[model samples]
Target chain A: MSLNVVSLVSVGRHPQSGRARRADQDGRAVELGLKLVAKALSVVHVGDPDDPVLRQYAGMGLPSMTILKQDKSIDAVPILSQFLQQEKIDIVLTGVRAESGESSGMVPYLLAHALGWPVVARVADIVSVKDGEAQVLLALPRGQRRAVSVKLPFIASVDHAAEIARQSAFALGLRASIESVESVGEVDRIRVDWQESVAKSRPKRLKTVKAKTAAERFKAATAKPEGGTGKVMKNETPKEKARAIFDLLLEEKVIR
Target chain B: MSNVSSLGISSLGIVRRDPRKEWIARNRLHPLYHEVINEGLGSVVGPSGLIRKNPHQIGFIGPNGIKRIDRLKGNGADTSNKRHGSAQEVVLPLHVVTTPDFYLVVVPDLVGGRLSSHDKDILGLAHALQGGMEGNGAVVAVCFGDVKETQFDLAGVDRLIHLTGTEFEGFTPEARVAALVQIDTQLAPQHWLFPDSIHGGTDLGSRLAASLGERPATQAWQVIPEKVVCRGAGGSLDIARQTPRIVMVLEECGNAIDETRHEVLPISVDALEIQSAHLIDHGQVAVDPNEIPLAEAEFIVSAGNGIHNWAQYHQTAQALGATEGASRVAVDDGFMPRFRQVGASGTWVTARVYLAVGISGAIQHMQGIGQCEKIIAINTDAGCDMVKRSHLSVIDDSDVILSELMQLAQEYGVNDKPSQENSPEESQNVA
Candidate 1:
């Protein structure tokens, strides 16, 4: 049986400029979803339908993208959950984590919980889908892949290590339409109350010191000394180099 | 000092001195500290007061001389102001009871018995609690698995709720999540913290969050009083929950705790029933203990993008009796196995000497070897980050240096005649 795969795409934000764009991982997810179900794939987003970044997905030749019109006050999980519930969706594909806005990396997990479906994270590739089970290659640390089989009607978050997303076509971008749907669920009061500000690089932490007396502890804790410049070696022969490396190793006790 | 009642049970255990030696071995028997030299790093001082001298650095000066104790030996340092002329009868606190508002659940690495470098859930939890709550309300830790009371670095925790059983053994996801759920229901903590690491943490946190009807923030970096801040696309985003119940999976917190305060709390063991699930197959994937012995390897020779011949690098590692490690790119290119990959996502090796070959140091790769005592880089790029990070960097071809190093090893009898001839294909790593 052909699967009904829903590509859950989100507008990614640029790191330095905070400009809305197609998240690299999410684009890869869209690419993967297209590869898996092809004509049956439906693109879904839970943000502004008129947002310019939504066109990036459409430019990838998606015929139509569904935008569940959720205001910033509404939680994406409940909105996406309600939207997905109305369809016979077999799989939900999203990026491992969103690049901007709440970036909890929990949307897929939350969706799994809300829909009572198993969720797999860091998915590198979908090996095969057969007999109500999907065999997948999970991306582990260090570029390793683990083969795991999960029963379908599941959610998968594509790993950054997956294939690069294809470039958006200009002609397709002109033709594709954003079908806006009514927002679902009540506004999440807590999310709406959250104060938003341009994020700055975090401040340096206070140095913790262990000392005998309170006075000495305070002195040591606040002492911010300049670190010494490291030594750079040059023009040494192979044997001499070997000896130097060996001595340093021995001093550091790398080898007995 | 008049404040005797404020100390915890672990504090009392310290007062019971070893009569044989006046100076206490500062470092406890946590598996991590077993191999490290305990002279400067251990608790060699007389039972004097421990102070948070510096971040991740603790110092106690006595007749034995000033010594820096391992920060991770015990729970957070005791704040009790006690001075001793010698090993006089030390006052020990019996029990510490407090109503815990925050719960830090430390799921044991059933495979390793004790938590490894990768699992810093407890540390992050403590930091978050101290940062947000200012250590006010109780920071209760619920440890699940065959973990002993002493195994955990319980520096900031107020109460330890240990759940251990034969059924709770191994990386049993269902049993572990069930146990945490039970604790959540019983304790009803305002904030719940889990390690946002790959090792079953994501699964547990997600399941627990779902079960409790609270959205969990995975890989959260900061925990303020009102919200948990995590890195999103543009910058950092704060995850604020309307209700009191917040499930958080922690990523790396910037600072490491000092060992000045070793407050060992009383342990309350609850044996939970085995909770079974058919979703994920149990006993399927088992990480071999010896597969990637990168942590314990004294010497490591790591290959990077520059090394085209991995077989030669592997042979060089065998010649020097060093563990073979690779950068992410090398592993990605299929030159080396993922187990041999070294970096943040890979093994955090505390090897005494790390020999880098042809690898430009990426920040992620540099994090893995940050703990290495000495780093020697051999890269053609003179200005690569690895060169700056290394103690000795040779701006030369790695192939020449490796052969020379192997020759030197053979001359020093480090590589036996038979061993020198053995190829990488004949012998495989124990991992």
Candidate 2:
């Protein structure tokens, strides 16, 4: 059997601001990492330092999952490369990029190039691993799929549509000891210099139109030749019975 | 033969190229890259001397965007001073990285309308990396240097790792993978980077990651020094090393550098050589039983749960072409493809004409029908997302709709005639 390492699963933890962190790690970014570990020989995990509630995820041992104490100084990319290489692991799974680090979705491309492996993007399935080759499924835009074949020792980015992402039984959410490793390679560092968003002297709220339910949408859908009853305007001429509405200001004297 | 197969690849054969393939070759191919691939093949070198990509080390994938097709396409025109207005013009945004020598670019030749986009991305990134790494350090890319897009202030970083082979064209994912792997082995750059899109670069990053053991993360929204967060499902998140491990960033995601003062740098080559060049292997797909040919599918019933009622389904199925299917409610209660579903997340369909009854419009479902060019939907609510987006929508009840429509099908032999010829633009609406 091929050397499978890592316990990849979609994981969830409520954002620090959201009152409560999420309980499930399914159907989310961490799930991509979880999926990468779906078939693991042994796995290690690292977590944010302040979050202790995240500990219960790695207890069950059938397919081991581990967690590391997250230090602000260490990034996940290099440590992960070290883990995979040291284990002689053959495949790695992850999302295109994390939901949080959305703007920097370049880790996989970098890691693949660094590890000297092929990185499959939007990969839906790892069909098989026989004779050093791995057949995979790729999901394209508009949900189209194409079956691609590549030799192993590659990384595949999981698609959000791959599956609902299997959930872990609550009863199995036991705590496990997560090993800690000092991270290496600090590329560039900057001093802590921060600024907060300045509040306006007179903060104004944005006016919003809400779509509470489907019925309120008749105008958007049915008013045009396009099938919906809602009116959909076409190209307009400047002077054909033009109408305008004006707002009157009360004498209090100001609108910016 | 499918015209797409002409290039031995599956992209649309619609060639949008300006017949400048030769011009592309001259500027694109760097002597460094050409020399490496050629020399590797020339000398029967083996894996002994190659710099195998080490997962234990760092796998830094750099950003390689498309070459700007039109020089002024994205210019903000910040160069001219504004004689009026309190605001000053901002310098045009450049996405070069802080370190150049610490990265290597991996590129496949061009294809599609993205050649220019890819070229710009690669060059922009190269400029960013080289700009940052100027005085010292070097980033190694995994290309057999038929072309390289590097921008350096000094000449030291101007190098290419070209692979020699026509099979390494842009769309040849398999061959590209093999060559990238070889390059990683020979060049030893930990972090691999490439641009998102704009060039013909797709799947090259992910595919390359799979070939190596390193865990690869895709889709990053931003990359700050020491912190690399990846976005996934439920505001899903994945971080690259916690703080330290060298994070190889693509140009757009990481810190920006100065590219305006970029100057061409010339570098001496080590004459790296490739011992072998061949195809990369992609394994196989497990065939699901339901995925077999449906030509023999007798009375095939495909229900878009979007179809709200049993009544309109029967009518629309008959009117356009197709056998009626139970609504999701009816099916779940024991009538539909309890084993089958349609649209993006469900069973992919290849029917005569999928009777889209009351189905809502979704990008996922649309994907399964890229091959199916025709769709007809019906529902009592004219505003159903599916119907409005379909080729035709009959506003009526299923029972009345189906019974009357089946009569039309039986009379006009609707199912016997193909609806494939419906205007494609109008037709795309249904799926």
User: What tens digits encode model 2's per-residue C-alpha lDDT throughout B71-111?
Assistant: 22112242211222113443433323344445445352333
lDDT of 1 by residue, B285-379 (tens): 32221233577666778889898655677767776767678899887877776877899999888876889999999999989988887788888
Which one is best on DockQ?
1
Model 1 chain B is weakest, by summed lDDT over 10 consecutive residues, at B1-10
Q: Please give, as one word, the docking class of candidate 1.
A: acceptable
What does the lDDT come to for candidate 2? 0.43
DockQ of each: 0.24, 0.06
